[model samples]
Target: MMTRAFRTAAVVGAGTIGLSWTALFAAHGLTVRVSDPRPDLDEAVTEALTRYAPHLAARGLDVTGLADRVRIAADVTEAVRDADVVQENGPERAEFKRELFATLTREAPAHALLLSSSSAIPSTAFTAQLPDEAAARVLIGHPFNPPHLLPLVEVVPGARTGEDAVRAAVDFYTSLDRTPVVERVEIPGFVGNRLQNALSREAVSLVQQGVVTPEDLDRIVTDSLGLRWATVGPFLGAHLGGGPGGYRHLVEHIGASMQSLTDGPAPDADAQERLIGAVEKAYGSAPYAELSETRDRRQLAVLDALSETTGTTTPKEEN
Candidate 1:
């Protein structure tokens, strides 16, 4: 067996997020067992890994024989039996997660780290049914979109999650070269998604109000805030924006302007349909494959450029 901090992983779910986790795990030399009830499990994983191979290579990861290290388990129990880490990407509903996690904690090894890729819905909500010992190992390890590419994994512990689990979660994600930020309070949507949702609401409002087309709105953000945030993040960027004064100075000077900006209107069903239509009209013409490929290519370029500036690169594992 391969020796590492966390040698074997069980990825529970085979959707986009689950498959991405599988690719990253196998790329890092962990033996992976993936489970999903979907009939096309084998085909889906094969296609996703094949598509992700080049991007993983560009990120300086050795993906040779990657698929050979991953296996499709017979069931959820089988998937997690001896797992050192269990990453659950199951449905986001609280009820579904409650039942799923109960099974996971019962089956997975006692010392395994149980993580969820849930966008929201705190671990406490679902883990209420679990015993203290089982609940201690489970927490939200939410990743930003496309877990294979993005560098962040928000580590939000449940109310009952032990300190040991919290520290272990951080260490495990760090080993994979992921930036794991722990949220002291487990708020809805956690930090990244809350900020992203706030921005998304305004972006939708802008397109719906005809302030800009969907395509132009994307360009505007990618050229400005998106690029800026990628570099310094929001608060740091604002600190720099303050000239020599820092965030406090910037806020004092532009506080009025910032406060004057009205909150975006909450869209009704009709408005949502229109927003979707507008977005589809703008970029839906392109095939999903083309769009995804273009996105990965550009994102890889940005990551490479950042690596050059920082004099560091992503850690590559021997497979």
Candidate 2:
């Protein structure tokens, strides 16, 4: 399925998230150039790729071949010189992103898809000032951490983003086996992060009020909502709840609850600290490793089952 490589792509920043993006793109048979000014960028990128090799294999990728296609660049200009796409994961600071995007826009191909992996920054804020207003080529391409495992990639267009650029970015990501969700408008935190922070804020409030321990609250999510969320999004889950018709009935009854819960105040500092302490006490020094391992394994099993059920066909060749 589209065995021809993606020609070339670049990953800027080469930090954990940037390296992870490089690994995923390389694993999908793209020739990747990674750039970061950090002194130890090479070592960090290599380490990330090494760790990701087997994970890609588990997801039906050919890691050994993919490794041969990657190149490390010493600077920004070299990285995007011939890149068809650039996934930038620079620091979250607005000025840094603005400067970085401006610089890359100068070197990147006129139509190159410039995607930011920033979790919080709206693409328009950073892209608005580029010469040629090539910021139109820039959009948010937020991938979940260790993107190789997660199929979801949010594609958010900035106010000035060209419609054609957005479409091409979606097509490119889809060709790499990612599920691309097009965000028609830019918003802070996008969708996933916003939902996560909302739940986390409430968890903090509960612990501050002594209504529940951190461990108990974590259990509720891990044991319930998390399971449902694994296969489908909340809206899809609600659509299914409507049974025979899908969404039509559910929206009529429960849409108001969703609206009502939208603007609740976030936790105060005292509540945040108490909850943070509860989490530290509950999980101690080592947190998320065991739980992550468990979740990854379970997710793999689920993928395996779904593959068998659907007849694990190779991706169809994209035109």
Candidate 3:
């Protein structure tokens, strides 16, 4: 089994995701070094932790009096100097990441696992800059926003990445009480992002064609598909589709329909205009602040309840 917690982790950037990453590490008793050139980086980190700490406490997390472990550094080299792992949350552009990783190779600790929080770009595009660098130790560790609440972290390894590095990452995230799904192949958008985009495209297209308003479309998914997805993934759901026979019946029948699916074109100008109009009509001009607040509370409540019944610590103790 991997260690319980990463000893030290450097978070290189203090954007929204970067700050949340910092909070997660600090709350978990990991020494976290946060690096960012932004003048307000420290302020941003403070604000993010302040906003999220309460929610974490409510979930039975161990953030009590542990916030001070977060250290703000002026640059990447200083941040990663003694760290066991480094999580880069820098600009999404490939060129920017290339330069960052190259600099990291020269400064970061020899065995520190370097990971990117990128949703789309793969490590292959950036690790090239560190030719002699341990490319195998560099991989993607994309987390859902508000990393504390949502536990899914997609782990994608580059072609040259070693198995040890990949497994280490999975172990590291799991230690943080997060779910880590590893992708053997480095496909574009990985899995979650692609699945989200596929659904989003259809949702947008529906609204653009006046088939349904945005609110109604969102409702349809949330009331139906999202509820199911929250419990089980699409493939597993399909596995249960044919009852005892599993997906065998699905493949024998609907398999042909799947093959006939097309790579449709992007939404056009008219479609966008219609979509915008539909949004206004369905949701009205009222601000969604109240709605968002309500949704957040409800989601967190459900998560807390689920955690109680299907949590890590209690089940292990019982077993």
Candidate 4:
């Protein structure tokens, strides 16, 4: 693996994801240059960092000099100048990303890893327009929402991407204390989002069928599947659920039942309406800011508990 240590990083985009990344980089003592077109970019980023600073501290990351290390760049080219890695969080349009990656390939340093935070689009979609040499350095380093707190970062490489570039990208994120999973294949949605959406589809179907209220459905997950998955992922959970016989026992006993559920009809238009109405009734009255704060606090508490049980510090402790 590449042992290159990055000192300065560039953030392309000052939106939510970009701002979160900027905060994390600065908190970890990397000089962060952020580029965005927003008129209130500086003010917005400062406010975001201020809000996240305490959370970072709670997770064992020092906030000292964090604000001093972050600067707003005048443009993309300027943002990436003298940087070791470029984390692009620009608009998620195919054409826009294609043009942006091409510009990044031309402007950024040849050795710097060109990483995109694109969720759906693969690296090939943007790197297709670049020459082989430049495209070899471009790939997707897609992070979960609220990346500063979440540990998962999917490192996916395009067909033309070099192994060294992929290794550098993975090492870069691993340095940031992220769980970097190198995807062997470049598929849409990677892995986490696909699993989340699959569960969501079934959850919506259950609610639409009036099998459970929206609140109850959420409660069921939190009390059972969610809690279980937090400790052991689905596959392992199934292996344990099968007792001493393991996964083979699970398949032999419930394979048909699982297959039947998988083959069930997907949610239709009426189901979508019902799901929407149920969700609206449950949370539509609350302000989004309040809900998000609640979510972050709960997530932090869970991480703390997990850390205590696992005898390992949270990712932020690496700082």
Which candidate gets the maximum TM-score versus the true structure? 4
> 3 or 4: which has the higher TM-score?
4
Residue pairs in steric clash, candidate 3? none
lDDT of 3 at 38: 94
lDDT of 4 by residue, 32-148 (tens): 999999999999999999999998898899999899999999999999988899999999898999998888888888888899999988989777768899999999999998999
All candidates' lDDT scores? 0.85, 0.79, 0.79, 0.84
Once fitted onto the true fold, the runs of candidate 2 whose alpha carbons sit more than 4 angstroms away are: 1-5, 242-319
Clashes of each: 0, 0, 0, 0
Candidate 2 versus the native: TM-score? 0.76
Candidate 1: segments with Cα more than 4 A from true spot: 1-4, 263-319
Tell me each candidate's TM-score.
Answer: 0.81, 0.76, 0.79, 0.82
Candidate 2 or 1, higher TM-score: 1
- Candidate 1: TM-score? 0.81
Better of 2 and 4 by TM-score: 4
Model 1: per-residue lDDT, tens digit, 159-262?
Answer: 99998888889988998889999998989999988998999999999899999999999989876777666655554455456555444566558855775675
Task: Pick out the ten consecutive residues of candidate 2 with the lowest summed lDDT.
Answer: 279-288
